[model samples]
Target: MSEPAAPADTIPHGDPFAIFEDWFAEARVTEPNDPNAMALATATPDGRPSVRMVLLKGHGPDGFVFYTNFESRKGHELAANGHVALLFHWKSLRRQIRIEGPISEVTPAEADAYFASRHPESRLGSAASDQSRPLENRQVYLDRVAAVRALYPDGNVPRPAHWSGYCVRPEAIEFWHDREFRLHERRRFVQSADGGWTSTMLYP
Candidate 1:
């Protein structure tokens, strides 16, 4: 893996959002799968943390977006705490991006649009499974799948009301680049009160 440039001026911009887009664009060409995959960390109201892998579906100046069942464990946690952290590591580039932010539900209309764009089977699965819920057995889960398949036999499934998208409006974004001898470079971009990003270097 190539080491990130020492001074961090090689990228020459303070806006982490734009930089993330650029990196993602490059990953699309180099990564073997799901370059948008991120590890999402959510905490309970009492501060117990849980982390899981989730696919990043959207990104813009507003924030990062991902879709899931609103009643899932992550959903319940986000609802109670309203904060999250996400990490994206691209092995091909030896780089990592971490974000911490406020979490909020995306508009239902927006979620509908994105959900409709998904593959029919995925849409059906979303409707069939109550994520993070306990099942009596594997056969019971299979039965639910069978039921959903019967209902949507023609492969035209609608998004469930319990399913939607969430957006993480970041307060901070940190970029990391691995280097030789464990001297990695870390730069943090924090959102300013005036709605701008300020970058600072950290020892690594």
Candidate 2:
């Protein structure tokens, strides 16, 4: 059985990143799978919005990071609109965090290091994928993967120039905790001009 929720009064205040780390650590222990998975929301230049799950490859006070093909749908959207929103929901802990921010590309070195760290097959698959593009059939993709694999049998596939990561520099972060009786606890932290954060509680 899951543990009881923490008392509302005990919700951490100040340093939202610290609170995030604490909750994320707990999530890693309780979430059945993909604790690092987050919903990444992006929008087209004209306001068409889309959301999809992406793994949180890295994060800290700097920002959260995720990598993808820069030519993909979300990637193209991000290129046109630097802003994005991310959601991290951990059902096991009945908690979710929402982040709004602008994105900036991660360094090529970072992308290369991460790509190299992936499993051999994962590396091959990502290298072979033409993300967000229509495919004639599964066999075509398989053949592409096979072709790439054949060229680099050791699975040292080079990261595609279009493949990279983005860091979301959050302007605002909101944390929500579920409680009993339909009541909930919420706190939102917005970055201040001085590079600190100002927080306020919201009715929930």
Candidate 3:
């Protein structure tokens, strides 16, 4: 008979970045929609917290990236305090990852390049919206979109200065997996002072 596979809780101690990539790739295959979607958590300098969903545009040793209008609530919050947290839950796979970090803005050139890669309609919508601000009516926003379309008939929309991306440089990462009979498994990795990772198992 073949030997049984190792338990999920028995995750090997290794490079956390490599482990994250492996799990993310599996999520991409199994998730029915927006596998890159993650919850971003930010706080005011005074300590109130807010969270919302955002798409993961990129990731590597540097960190995870996502774009938004710099004038938005998240923008304001991040400007005041760079500390942030991210959560990814793959329902189909019964797995979750938590990340905590400080963020930094991407270069203007990088923002422009990503903006150019978006669909023309998406570009127009982004350029026109005063994100996170109260609007008088839906028609007002539609009219703004129409105005942008008229100005960029050739679909050559220049990126707005207020629109850009931020990268979160993680200080810690934790992975959780659902197991039989509610015996979940949790593994956390904390960046060490000497630039290595320390892994620990948490009761679940």
Cα RMSD of all models vs. native, in order, equals 3.1, 3.2, 2.1
* Cα lDDT for residue 194, candidate 3: 92
lDDT of 3 by residue, 23-139 (tens): 999999999999999999999999999999999998998999999999999999999999999999999989999999999999999998999999999999999999999999999
- Each candidate's TM vs. the true structure? 0.92, 0.95, 0.95
Q: Write the per-residue lDDT of candidate 2 for residues 1-204, one digit (tens) a residue.
A: 998876765467789999999999999999999999999999999999999999999999999999999999998899999999999999999999999999999999999999999899998899899999999999999999999999997778999999999999999999999878768889999999999999998898
| Model 2: lDDT of residue 182 | 64
For candidate 2, list the clashing residue pairs, or say none: none
| Per-structure clash totals for the candidates | 0, 0, 0
Query: Which stretch of 10 consecutive residues in model 3 shows the poorest summed lDDT?
Result: 3-12
lDDT of 1 at 182: 71
Error of 1 at 180 (Å): 2.1
What residue pairs are clashing in model 1?
A: none
Worst 10 residues of 1 by lDDT: 4-13
User: Which residues of candidate 3, in runs, are more than 4 Å off?
Assistant: 1-8
lDDT of 3 at 203: 94
Between prediction 1 and prediction 2, which has the larger TM-score? Answer: 2
lDDT of 3: 0.94
